[model samples]
Target: MLEVRDLVVNYGEAAALRGVDMTVRSGETVSLIGANGAGKSTLVKALMGMQPVTSGSVLLDGEDISRRQASDRPKLGMAIVPEGRRLFKDMSVKDNLRLGLHDAAARRRGADGLDLAYDLFPILRKRSRQLCGTMSGGEQQMVALGRALVSRPRLLILDEPSLGLAPIVVAQVFEVIEAVVAQDVTVLLAEQNMHRALSLSDRGYVLADGSVVLEGTGTELLQSDRVRTAYLGES
Candidate 1:
């Protein structure tokens, strides 16, 4: 459903991504795993049109959207739960989620989208009026996920969804993601938690120093000597 070809991005003279190529098939969950400086987030930002692409093409359902504005991405069936959650801390939970429906078509289906989110995280319904900043980190993360899901995107991109949460909360978040996958939404997960990410993925890509170092099915990757040594801390 999404294809990235020869994708490159630079911050002035320093390249953050170099000729990266990857694809996410319809209704599949793909994981991008790497260390802190591996450019996983950069690639995610580029895909969402939040970062400037130096040279490359991003295609969604065969349409080149590399030049589309960030605001236009959601309307074209793309949504992201960005790194750090990036929620409106001062806004009410419901208001924050409502922002996801800015697109006219999504707005028309807003009620259903909201229902899906509330169903996925029932606590959200109870805390709809609370200020996001006051919620615990796990609750805040739930809000972020709900906001992205509320758009009913075809391709859902989650960047570092497990970052900064307790282990139990991380497990819960992944469970929610699993439910999302069951519903047929194509997911591109950029995560540092290799084991969890690959375990849930249908396919996985290993990024290193701005390029794809390895790509394979999830179980294949998990058992790889290289992956075990590099990311999994095995000898």
Candidate 2:
């Protein structure tokens, strides 16, 4: 459903991505796994057009969208839940979800956006009128995912939803992800936690030094010696 070819991204004199190539199929959860500074986020930023692509192409449904503006991505059925759960802290939970639906056309197609989002995170429904900043970390992450879902995106790009949460909460978030995939929304997951990510994804790509070092089915990577030491921390 999405294709990124030889994507290169730079920040002034520094290169964040170098000739990176990746793809995510419809109904598949593809993961980009790497340590910090590996350029996984840079690849995402470039795809969303938040970061400029020095050279390469990003395609959505066979159409080149490498140069499109970030603001246009949401209308094209693409949305990202950034790493930090960047919610409008002072705003009510309902308003945060409303921000996800950017286009009038998309909004008109659905009156149940809030209902569906709340259903995805029952906790959000219970706390819909509360200030986002006052919620616990897990609750805040739920709000983030709920907000993203309100957009009715065909492809949801989530950057580290499990960051800084308890293991149980992380598992809960992944359960939501698995359920979302069942609803047929394609997912691109960028995660630092290799085991959690690989378990959830059908396929994955490992990046190092701003380039793709490996790509394989999740099970394959999990069992490989290279990934075991470098990522999985196994013997």
Candidate lDDT (C-alpha), each: 0.92, 0.86
Write candidate 1's Cα lDDT for 81-184 as tens digits. 99999999999999999988888967765558888889989999999999999998788888998899887888899999999889998988888788788888
lDDT tens readout by residue for model 2, 1-235: 8999998888899989999999999889899999888998888888888988899899999999999898889878888999898899999998898887768755864467888888878888888899999998777877888778886888999987888888888887788777777777889999988888898789999999899999999989888899999888888
| Full-model lDDT, candidate 2 | 0.86
Winning candidate number (TM-score): 1
Error of 1 at 82 (Å): 0.8
Candidate 1: residue pairs that collide: none
lDDT measured at residue 139 in model 1 versus the true structure, 0 to 100: 84
